[model samples]
Structure formats: C-alpha cells, structure tokens
Target: MEAANLCAIIAHVDRVSIGKRLAEARDAAGMTQDSVARAVGLERTAIVLLEKGDRNLKVPELVQIAQVLGRPLSYFVETPVPAAVSRRSAPSLAHASTRVLDIEIDQFALDVRALVRLGLLSGAERDARARVPRSHRAAEDAATSFRRRLGLDSQSPVLNLGRVCETAGLYTFAAALGESGPDGACIEVADDSGTVGAAVINGDAGSGRRRMTLAHELGHWLFGDAYDHGASRDSERMISSFAVHFLAPRAGVQKVWSENSNSPIRDRALAVGVEFQLSWSATVGQLMNLALISHAQHDDLKLREPRAGDYLRLGLSWVEELEAPYLSPGFMAACLTGYTEEKLTEARVLGLLRGRLDASQLPQIEARSLEDLRQAFMGHGG
Candidate 1:
C-alpha cells in the first residue's frame, strides 16, 4: 500500500512539473488561461487547476493544448526544462507590443532545438559580431566591409538574401506577423554544440519591404544587438544606414546611375529600385544621399513611387517564396528526413513545420507503435 501511494505521489509530481511548463508556454504565446481553456474545450476553472498541478492531464488533452500553444509535445515532456527565450525587437518596432511576434519567434527556436536534438540539423559556431561606431559613415564602412566579406562586388544585387544569411550561419525564417506587427525580429540561442542565430521576418510585408526588414535584422545579428533589451535611436539609425548601404552600395548605385544617366531622375530611381530590390522610399533616399538627385528631385521621386505594374513591367516578379509561416529549405529538409527515418511522428513533424506542410503533403510512412518502441528500447539494453 505504501509503494502504491509513493507511485501516486511521483506521478502527481510529474504532472505538476508539466503543468508549470504549460503555463510558461501559454504566457509566452500571449494566451490567457481562459483562452487556452476555451480553445481546448475546457472550463476556465479546469485550466486553472491543470496549471496549478492540482489535476492530471490526459495525453489527448495535452495534445490539444500543444496545438493551441504552438509547441511540440516533447517540449513539455523534456527534462532540464525549456530555456526562456528573450524577446528582442527591431528598433522601428520598439514602441509596439510584440506579443504575437514573440510567439512566432519562440516557436521557431523550439523547432530549431528539436531538429538539432534529432541530429537532423547541425549546430553552427557563433560568428563574431561586427563593431561599428554610432555614426552613419562608420555604419556604411561596416556595410562595405561586410559586403566584401560576402565576396559581393560593388555592383552585385543580393538576389537571395535568405540563402546568403543561412550561409553566413543565420537561421532565418518567415512568419505572418499581420500588418501592424513588427517588420522582423532576431535572437541568438546557445546549446550544447554551439550557439545559433535565428530571425523571423514579416512574411506579410511587401517583397521589397520584407527584404529590407530581413537586412535590418541581419544588421542587428551582425552587430550582436539582437540580444539587447531595447535598441536605442542612434543604434537604429546606424543599423538602418548599414542595411541601406548593405543592400545598395554606393559604387553599385553609381554604376547603375551612370548606366541610366540619360534617364530622368524618377526613372533612374525606379531603375535603382528594380536592380537593388529596394523599396521606392529606400531607392529615393539612396539617390538623395548619393547626390545623384537633388533634394527637390528626391521629394518628387518619393511621391511618384513606382506601382505594381512598374515592377512587373521591369521584369521583377513578386516572390512569395518567403511568405510568413514559412520554413527555411534546410530546416524543412531536416524535418522531412526525420519523418522518413521514423524518428519523428507525423503529428510531431507537422508541428515542427508550423503547419506549412500538410499531412497529405507528407510522404506516407508506417509509424512505430508503442509496443515497437518498447521492444526497441529493450533490445538496446545490455
């Protein structure tokens, strides 16, 4: 009787530990206990008890809660507890509350953690952050230096910013951060192997706008400011300068300007916008800063922004590849590999993919039953 009572106490303690994690994840997801209860078809009081560790959680109930919280089941069951991810916002969005953005970023980090644990993804060494003074000129110089490091010529357009970032050891993803949310966010996490940097861009933003946000976040990562509690106005300005010059180097802009010397100032700005994949406003700003166009020309050109037709007419297609809630190719590939190897179940794989890939889209595979897992474990015993 005493042994049975002890077993009961042990089980209760486990559930209590899980309850604590659930509460933490709910808060990180910006969900109220009542909201989670409603989403899980439970009464508010039930959620309160569950989180308080006063009640047992069934497997099915936990599964439903996992879906609502946007977390993997393993995250709740894993030992050593999940590390708390810090919220780091872009300077432009420092004023706005980033609860939703924080949720997406946190989920992405969890997915990365799972992949790395499964041996599906390799850990990367942390890159040293660049030190740039709090001046626009210094920022531009740092941008030029970074461009050189990437082996990009002054005239090269970064056709694949996402891939470039990944190659540079940044795990970049996209999330649909609605219209009012931040343009992007970034954070670096440390694991047993090493540290990894991840950034989430607002996939809902325009292609040019999205790319700019990504570049801006990349600047934060390079400057090692993604871990800062809040970005200062001066830091934001320097990073903005770095991003602009990083995307549209002066020498490249000069070359394009010289190529279109015969075109009107407005036309030249459009050409630069297309070539560098910069937003209309950024293009005009670059032209003005380069002294390629007068301040008055800059003002007029900004108003006479290029239309959608202008981009299509100029042979630039709207690339939806980076749309929000999207995963990087490498990450997606690792998830798929883990699924095919029977290391991850369908539900877990779907969670890791963030619903970007449907179950129907997944390749059919025979999943191991509980008995099979038990037998495999027994076989491994000496």
Candidate 2:
C-alpha cells in the first residue's frame, strides 16, 4: 500500500513537470490556450488544466499536442531546456500581423535548439562573431571583413546565399510572412547548453528582395543585433549598408560596371543586378553610393526597372531562388538523420521539411521484425 502511494506521488510530480513544459512550449509557439485546445481537440478548460498541472495527459493526447505545437515528443517527456529569445523585426511591421511571423521565426529557432539538444546540430558560435560595427562606414568595412571571413572573393557573386549562411553557422529558412509583414526576422535562442541562431526570410517577397532581406538579417545575426526591432533609423541604415556591401561589394560593382561601361545605364544596372543577384533598387542604390552614377542618373535608372524578359534576353535564368518550401541544409540533414534513426516519425519529418517533401518520398523500409516476410515476398525462401 505504501509503495502504491509513493508511485502515485511520483506520477503526480511527473505530471506537474510535463504541465510546466507544455505551458512553456505553447508560449514559445505563440499559441493561445484556446487555439491550442482547438488544435488538440480538447476544451480550453482542459488545456488550462493541463498547463496548470491540474489534469493528467494521455500519451496519445500528448502526442497530438506535441505535433500541434511543432515540438518533438522528447521535448515534453525529457527535462526542459532553458531558453531565452532575442529577436528583431522591421519596425514598419511592428503590428499584429507581424506577430504571427514572429511566432513562426521563434518556432524555427526553438526547433533548431531541439536538434542541438539531440546532438544532431551545432548551436550558435559566439566566438565566431566580432564586435558590432559602430558606424555605417564601419558596417561597410565589416561587410568586406565578412567576405574575407567567409573566404568569398571580393569580386564574386554569392550564388547560393542560403548555403553560404549555413557555412557561417546561421540556419536560414523561408516562411510565408505575407505582403504586409516584415521582409525577414532573425532570432537567437540561448540555453545553458548553447545558443541557436536562425533567420526566416519572407518567402512571399520577390526572389531578389528575399535575398536582400536575408542578407540584412544575416547582418543582424553577425553583429548580435537581435533585439533592435529596426527602432533606430541610423542603425537600420547601417545594417542596410552591411547588406548591400555584403551582397555586392563595391569592388565587384566597379568591376561589373567597368566591364559594361559601353552599355546603357539600364543595361548596366540589369547586369549588376543579375550578377550580384540584387534587386534593381539595391543595384542602382549601390551605384549611386559609389558615385558611379549621379543622383539624377540614379533616379532615371531606378525608374526603368528591368523586367523578367530582360533577364531572359540576357540569358539569365529567372529562377525563384528564395522561394518557399525551402529548408536549411543543416536543418534538413538533422531531420533526415533523426528520421532514419527512428528517432522521428514520418509526420514529424514531413512537418520539419515544410512541404519540401511528402510521405511517399520518405525512405521505404520493411520493419526488422517483418524481414523474413519481406524475404518471402522477394522469393528468397528461408
């Protein structure tokens, strides 16, 4: 009787711990109790009870909740890891709509943290960062330093920005932030174990714009400007400087400009834009900043933005480079490892892939227990 009572007490303690974790994960996901309850097919009251340790959770129910929360089952069953989030969004998007994306980006970072915990991913490397550039010129210089740091040639275009970012230790992904939301948002989630850095660009934006936004967010992550929220106009300008220079270094721009000196300004802008994978505005703006074009010339060039046909005529591929259903290489690798090792379910793997793949695309494997039956089907008699 005494053992039964002790076991009951331990179970109660476990329930309380799980309840606390549920609440934390819900909060991290930016989900309301009512919303979560609806997704979990439970009453709001039930969710409240679950989060308050006033109710016991069935395994199936918990699994459903975990899926709804975009969390791994281990996240709830194991001891909770401590996490602190530092985030920044475009101040222009500091409204209700952006909050939805804020949740999305935060969830991405938390997912990366979960992968780190599982020894499948590495956390943020604070040691890799240098001091934040203090001025616009400094930011520009830092951009050059960044090129050197990444082993990128000063005159080379970054063909694969997503892969490049992963090389620099920042996980990058795309999210549907809609037309009115911020261009992108970056987050750093710190725990006792380490910090996980992630950036989510607005996939709905134009491909060039998405690439520029990603570079802007990469500036934020590299400089530890996690919580700026674009509050300061000067700070925003500095980051913009970083982004422009990072994407199209001044030396690269000059080289391209000189190479196309005989071309019309529109053609020249298009050439620079295509080569650097920059938007027309960014390309022209960089030209103006370099004093290669007068203010009047900049205005005239900006007015005549190149169309898709123009790029096609130039033999440039008009691929949507930063389109959605995009996952970072590292994140995808971790998901594959987790799934193949039977540590993650097909649903969870699909969820993490975010439409990059589907169920039919997963590896086909007969259960080990059914191997003999599989051999019989293959006509290998035992």
The whole-model lDDT of each prediction reads: 0.75, 0.75
Candidate with maximal TM-score = 1
What clash pairs does model 2 have?
none
Per-residue lDDT tens digits for candidate 1, residues 192-280, read 75566677888887777878888887787787864443545578778888999999999999999899889777777777888888878
- Residue 303 C-alpha lDDT in model 1: 84
Candidate 2 structure, TM-score to reference? 0.74
For model 2, the superposed segments whose C-alpha errors exceed 4 Å read 1-97, 127-129, 227-233, 364-382
Q: What TM-score number comes out for model 1?
A: 0.79
lDDT of 2: 0.75
Per-residue lDDT of candidate 2, residues 1-382 (tens digit): 0122334343545787778778877886779999999997899999999988888877668778987987655555543223222233244432133554655675577677767767777666654445456686898899998899888889998877888887766788888777656787776756556676677888887888888888887877787754433335466678888999999998999999999899887887888888898888998999999899999999998888788899888677645677775778878989888888677778667767777888988876546668766876789553
- TM-score per prediction, in order, is 0.79, 0.74
Cα lDDT, model 2, residue 361: 84
